[model samples]
Target: MIDKKQWQAEQAQFNDTSRYNDIMDKPRHVSHAHLPMTGRDRAGQFAPFAALTGYHELLNKIAQRYVNKKYPTGAEEQAIFDFFHQLPTGDAVRLELTYFNGESGYYEHYRGTLDHVNWAQQVAYFADGPQIPLRNIRVVNRKGNAHGQG
Candidate 1:
């Protein structure tokens, strides 16, 4: 290992800020009016560029897996219909809903209180503000009740 004094002395030359200080103190030849770029424009010139355009978006799309809407079987349909018929008036019953989200083109499962069941429109409105079509529903689970119990 080199001696501490010798090592510090060698480093002292590189640590000198005199050259940089002199360059900064020197007046620039270009006038403010003649300057081609503003601060924002100058910063944008050094901004990072995407090597592969849309690569991140493509990766995100691939990473995001979605489930397709599942059609209910005959027995499941019957049970769901029965559960809806037995619901007490104005009562908020907890329900697990599996329905299609058109915006995402995926089937998402949600658990919330059933606010209204529109038989004529064939839609079930949840308390959390999702109006799910009866045909789009894959599964219906009544909270705190077993299958065919509620």
Candidate 2:
């Protein structure tokens, strides 16, 4: 490698700007064929690109491996069935629900009014718009009552 003094002496010639005198004060060149992009548009050009598409969703599926779908025990299942049997059809009652989500292998909880049960379809409709299948339900209780009391 060249000594520091020698490198500095060699680079000193580039510090002289007398050769660029003709264009030193000229305005910057602008393209006529393309309009200037906005700051956001320019930034997006350098943004990280996902070469492996759907990698994030794959990672999410892998992360969900630790979450097992919760199933109701025989007693809990009986309690859920009893709750439905005791509540008169078409009579709305406030309830909290814990049910399995097979798609994500996790138990989801909801608190809403039990709109009615559709025995023919074996689905329990909630006032808030979820129609959960009876088999997937793990826990169901009247809102004010303690668990398994329903």
TM-score, each model?
Answer: 0.46, 0.48
Give the poorly placed runs of model 2, Cα more than 4 Å off: 1-67, 147-150
Expressed as tens digits, the lDDT of each residue in 18-130 for candidate 2 is 99999999999999999999999987886666456677778777767536855567887677777788886666688887877666677788888888888899888888898
lDDT scores in order: 0.73, 0.76
Query: Across residues 73-146, which tens digit of lDDT does each residue of candidate 1 receive?
Result: 78877777777888897877888766667557687778888889899998899888988877666666766564
Runs with alpha carbons beyond 4 Å of true place in candidate 1? 1-67, 146-150
Model 1 poorest ten-residue lDDT run: 141-150
Report the error of model 1 at residue 131, Å: 0.1
